[model samples]
Target: MDSSQRIYWTAFYTKPRNEKKAAERLTSKGFEVYCPTRTVLKQWSDRKKKVTEPVFTSYIFAKVDETSRLEILKDTSIVSNVRWLGKPAIIQEKEITEIKSFLEDFPRSELAHGDFQAGNKVQIDSGALSGQSGVIRRTQGNKAFLIIASLGLELYAEISLNHLKKVG
Candidate 1:
């Protein structure tokens, strides 16, 4: 296929609570769609049941070429493509594979919102300091400066914000 006809995995923002519907419609039209979801136990006033919901609220991914992208936007449930620098954000296949693998391993895992701020205690989730808890001294862009107390001394290190999770 030519470059214009090459398939790309692009993310789209959907109408509130319309992710599954959009995925269905797109698939029915012969477009490839992916909507990552998780099963959770939800409790109502008098009942509890397992419900599957989209992992990313109001978001779904579809594989489409440039020509079909216009057709995708015509769906009422799709608001618009997720954009970066005025262009549709293209998602890497490897990243999508990782997400699938992660969900398979931890089906009930919840996504944590990382709004790192100074003085918040967080635990390193990966890299050399994985599992170590530290207090954020400050944040700069995508990096967090942490003060890790160990062996009666405070050790300082800068870690990527992606590797840290807020600790309660």
Candidate 2:
């Protein structure tokens, strides 16, 4: 029974795109839950609408103590065992927090990704590429990729909000 209520990598089988619902159910049970989702733009005949979709498909995260494993397993929405190396895996709370933070702060921070594409000017806002200029790309999910336009190649790295800032 850790005070942090350590996180676990659960291999839950959701109801075919019902991951969010399942996560919510578990959350209400007093378990710390995480289901990373993003709003995707869908163009309809009438207009464009942003629909919330799960990033990891059927996967969801939960934080609990060892004693709660049985209750979690008994959960109606969670269909499979949480796993790691052939056993129920215990993921540290730190990793869950980091991923959550990245999703939340994506708007303000700069982003970088590997593989360059056309018409991108290279710019590196952080790391070895920091302060360097490169091709910038406005990609899906508000992610930006820095590439070398001349080479038509993107830097071989994918960074989220954690290590991103637009180069001045």
Candidate 3:
């Protein structure tokens, strides 16, 4: 591929509960897709069962070149690619690797969310809180206090240190 056709990883927003479908469609169309999933055990009145679900709801990653950007956007399940400065957001390979490594270690860890705080800005790449951005208030052992801002509220959550990556 030429320079203009060099492939980059991009995050695409899917319709509600359509992350897997969107990934499948993108894959079937010969594009590399990533939608991390984990198995979680749930309890009910009768019994408990393990269910596999997407780590990041309404979002999936795709490896595509600039020339194929419009083609990938044609999928119905994909609402649009996540953008930065009016352009499609390009996710770094290192961030992707960190997310994969996190999933391998904490396949079933619960994700916590909260608002901003005073510390280094970070992003949760995997788990229930994938796609959330926050600040690291502190870290004790393997646990981190994350302050995530959402819906105009500052929320605080304690998460694993391994699940976080410094956001650029």
Candidate 4:
């Protein structure tokens, strides 16, 4: 592929509860899409059942070149490309791989939104996210929610306290 056709993994926001549909539509149109999902046991008054849900509620990633990027916007389910600093946010391939590996290893993990407060900077000393540095966004019990910022996007993960060391 030429420079203009070089594929980039770009993040996009989908309409509410339309992640899977958007992924399917984009894939059918020959776009490589990744809609990370995990299976979890959901309990209702009647019974418990396993359900698969998107890891990122309304977000999906697509591999698109410069021209194809615009084409994706034409899809009704796709709200728009995730932008940071007035440009499309390009996600790194390694980060996407890490997310997939994390979901496989921790299928029951939960994603939560916490207050965006300034906190100490720390580096992961061990485990899957080892060597990654992020600000400790929040903490509850033994888990610390970290915001790892890259390419103007924030990747949030709840990590064990034992795996982090406060950066000097």
Candidate 5:
């Protein structure tokens, strides 16, 4: 990457089960990559119980110097795409920090991601996930999983129930 150009986060397609592999390779080479994941239950044939695994599979966000875009994208195991307005998506470091903070602050059961079939639009007015907006996907018993989409990727990440509510 050229010194004058800036690094931006981008979405990549990885070989099945290759998300961790891609991240390891890029970060080891001095690139910043993010593969946000959460554990979910996977029902197996041989087991009566479920296994916890990644929510989003084979997808990651990477930051590459504008100059290194070409070289960095040459990995045969990963395919890349610019996600922000045709340019590589520049995810503010602060945003990632906030996400990390949220994970540490909230328990896994506190987040939810379901179809918003019956809820109100909401804006997270404050806290780590402030500025996020979504509709209540629904509640399972007493817990809720407010659904919000990452504007950059247009992909949804279930957020903390306490962070959202009816907007109007």
Candidate 6:
């Protein structure tokens, strides 16, 4: 296959509340799709229900080549492929594995908005997240919570102070 036809993971934006539907359709068409979701206890005045919600509200990842991307886009539930620098945003395999492993370890972790001062980038020099760079969302004493944005989605991970260093 030509370079443009080479397979890679790309993030797609789905219509509101259609993340699951989009993923299911893509998978049925033979595209590998990843839609990480978590079950949470949602409560109301009269009852509590366990609801499975997308980790990244309206986004899903799919493995497809540029040649088949148009087919994916034609799915009614999918709005568009996420773009980075005017091209389809490609997700690294390692990053995908890292996110999967992270969710497995911390299934209920919530995504947080990072408010680090401008120009601050933190990299984990050691630990499970070693070599990963992210923005520090918050800190408590000797621990820090990081927000990593990859493939158009944001994920949160907590690490000890010593494992992190300001790089850029």
The better-scoring model by lDDT among 2 and 5 is 5
Clashing residue pairs, candidate 3? 114-148, 114-155, 114-156, 115-147, 115-148, 115-149, 115-154, 115-155
Q: Pull out the clashing pairs in model 2.
A: 110-164, 116-154, 120-135, 121-134, 121-135, 121-136, 122-133, 122-134, 122-135, 123-134
Question: All candidates' TM-scores?
Answer: 0.64, 0.56, 0.61, 0.61, 0.52, 0.63
TM-score of 5: 0.52
| CA deviation > 4 Å runs, candidate 3 | 1-3, 109-168
Best by TM-score: 1
Model 1 clash count equals: 0
Per-candidate Cα lDDT values, in order, are 0.88, 0.61, 0.81, 0.83, 0.62, 0.80
What does candidate 3's lDDT look like per residue over 12-125, in tens digits?
A: 898999988888878888888899998765446676566678999899988889867778889999888899999899999888889999999886745322222349799998
How would the candidate models be sorted by lDDT, starting from the highest?
Answer: 1, 4, 3, 6, 5, 2
Q: For candidate 4, what's the RMSD?
A: 11.6
Backbone clashes in each candidate structure, one number apiece? 0, 10, 8, 0, 3, 0
Q: In candidate 1, which residue ranges exceed 4 Å CA deviation?
A: 109-168
Q: How close is candidate 6 to the true structure, as a TM-score?
A: 0.63
Highest lDDT model number: 1
Instruction: Point out the higher-scoring one by lDDT: 3 or 6.
Output: 3
Clashing residue pairs, backbone N/CA/C < 3 A, model 5: 1-67, 1-68, 112-145
Model 4 vs. true fold: TM: 0.61
Worst 10 residues of 1 by lDDT: 107-116
Give lDDT: candidate 4, residue 168: 64
Candidate 6 clashes between residue pairs 3 or more apart in a chain or in different chains: none
